[model samples]
Target: MKEIRVGLIGFGTVGSGLAEVLLAQQERLEKRSGLRIRLAKVADINISEMPPQFGDVALTNDAADLIGDPEIDIVVELIGGIQPAKTFVMNAIAAGKHVVTANKALLSQEGRDIFAAAARHGVEVGFEASVGGGIPVIKALREGLVANKILSIMGIMNGTANYILTRMTDEGIPFDEVLRDAQQQGFAEADPTYDVEGIDTAHKLAILMTMAYGMNITHNDIATEGISRIEPVDIEFAREFGCRIKLLAISRNHGDHVEARVHATMVPERHLLASISGAFNAIHFTGDMVGNVLLYGLGAGKMPTGSAVAADIVDIARNIATGSVGRVPPLSYLPEEISDRKITPMEELSCPYYFRISAVDKPGVLSAVSGILSQHDISIESVIQKGRKQSGPVSIVMRTHTALESSVSKALAEIDALDVVAAPTVKIRILEEDE
Candidate 1:
């Protein structure tokens, strides 16, 4: 059997897990893959103390050692960042080595250049772990659903954000309180702007959109909104409407253009997505032939994500063993077929909306608000007034019929500017999914 040597960079949580999988399951992997897969070297900034089980493997601080090594057939990059990770992966590809990575940020931002370089170098890139860690969604999209025309995708891609929202929905906890608790529980990072602000979800969405539509989309192209503005009162109101709020990364293909956005969306309480609570992740895909398919699992962790990385390694190793490199394109589309598609402007999209307006209890407040919405061509579907306050502002919540985003924005601006309006209006999109 041909021996395919593996070199891993970054010895952090995921890297350590990959090492464990590669070392502990060496014989099993060889038997399953029909090739001798070996962990030849590991590179990290700090390698002062090596793990006892990896005594036979070489360790180095310089990543170039792995890229430059003639025997190293695959370079696995577990480091999460843009700088040196991009440089190292590019150099590895330039050296004619197959690459596997879990860096979503880098791939979402710089995938075109990276994939183009790989194509030029005649090596495949495996990045199944980048989007939904260990969920195998990437593989499913590339192979399993390749024959179908993907119509739409809605996913809870960020664990930190999902965890925060799940707790808020279940316990009626406020966003701030839940976020603090998630941080304490190691579910959120100290500086969680990426996860909480929907940036992380957008990154993963970009990757998925690329695979689904064969389009050149990036995180910057996504219209992103966070969950920081969500409150306990909003969750209560959602329950009144028989719904739950989840931070959703949504994309839809419209023939000429595509829609991509990440925001706090109100989904029907009975929907499967609303029930996906806590830190777990779920992605719902709509394809022409498959109709609707869901993939759910742990989005991030040591063993789960490590398992994804190992699967990629074995796949690439099998390709090497058979001398059939580049059998599957990284994006599941031919390089020539992948091109920039028009992204529909967020303002042009139409959807039903939920609005919470703080207004002083008065005789003409409702009429005035409805008048403004009507003028903007937004019709009210339902309205609720919570409590009565003679002096202070009371919450007036309204659900509107399907309206263009631009019209809603204009109406909200006019309503918020009224003398009776006390605060900026809080708006959330309502997703009407088929059962």
Candidate 2:
């Protein structure tokens, strides 16, 4: 059997995992693919800490060494960051080597240049593990559901955020408290801003949007909202209304435009996504032909993520052996065929909302809030005014049907202006099953 030599960049969490998978599965892979997969070289910022299993394979602190290594045929990049990782990937592609990466941030931020470099060299770039850690979502959107028009995708993409939210809902704890626990338990990073702030989900959503819609998009265009503002009261209120709150990464393809947004949403309790707990992730995609399909599993882990990287290596090796260069389009369609449509802004999104308002227990307050919604042509689906906990403040739950985000904002603004209301309104997107 011909051997496919691999060069790995960034021996971090995912990189080390890749090494373990290839070594452990080498025998099984050789039987299945009839090819020997070898690690010709590995580049990391700190090579001294690499586990003993790395053995005698060439190791270097400099990434450039791996790009031009003659023994390396396919370059697998797990190095996360903009400058060096991008430079290494582009250089590898320019050197006429196939590339595989799990760097969704880099891809979502600068995929255009990376793909161009691969196209120039007539090679393929595999990123099946980029978006969803273990779920073959990139493959699903790119190949499996190729014939169907993807209507929308709703997911719990960030495992850290999901873990925190799940704990908050189940244990009735505060966000900050659970985040500290997550860090201590190794479920979150020391600086968890990216995952907690919705930036991580935005990157994943950006990649998914490109694959599903064949469109060029960036992380900046997506409307992003973090879960920092989610209150436990809202979670209890959601349960009372038969719902659960989860951070949702959403994208939709309309006839003329595409909508991308990531935010905390109140999904009904019966919804599949709402049931996902802890660090697990799930995504529901509605396609014109396939109707509704779901993919759920460990969104991030050493072994699971490593399996995805190994799968890409097998693909690259098989393609090389068969004398076939290009496999599938990088963005799920030909470069020139990618869409140029704009991503609809958050203010323009249309969906129902769950609002928690604190109002003074006085005459005509409910009518005043309803009047504001009616003025904006936002129809109310239901309203619950809780028993007054105090004479000055009360909690009200208002559920509405589909309406424009701008209209909802305006209505909330008007409702806030009333002297009876105590504070600004807190709004959570409502995802209807049939919508």
Question: Per-prediction TM-score, please?
Answer: 0.97, 0.94
- Model 2 residue runs over 4 Å out of place are 360-364, 387-393, 418-422
lDDT of each: 0.92, 0.88
Instruction: Find the 10 residues in a row with the least total lDDT in model 2.
Output: 47-56
Clash pairs (backbone) in predicted model 2: none
Tens-digit per-residue lDDT, 1-435, candidate 2: 899999999888898899999999999999988999988798887766556777768888887888888778999999787878898888999998899999989999999889878888899899988877889888888889999999998899999999999999998999989999999999999999889989999999998888888888989889898898887888898898788998999888886888899999888888888899999989889999999999999999888898899998998788888887787786778888886787777778888889989988878888888888999999988888888755669888899999999999888988998888899888999888764
- Over 132-248, each residue of candidate 1 has an lDDT whose tens digit, in order, gives 898999999999999999999999998889899889888888888888898898889899999999999999999999999999999999999998988999999999998999999
| Index of the highest-TM-score prediction | 1
lDDT of 1: 0.92
For candidate 2, the TM-score is 0.94
**Best-fitting candidate, scored by lDDT:** 1
Per-residue lDDT for 127 in model 1? 97
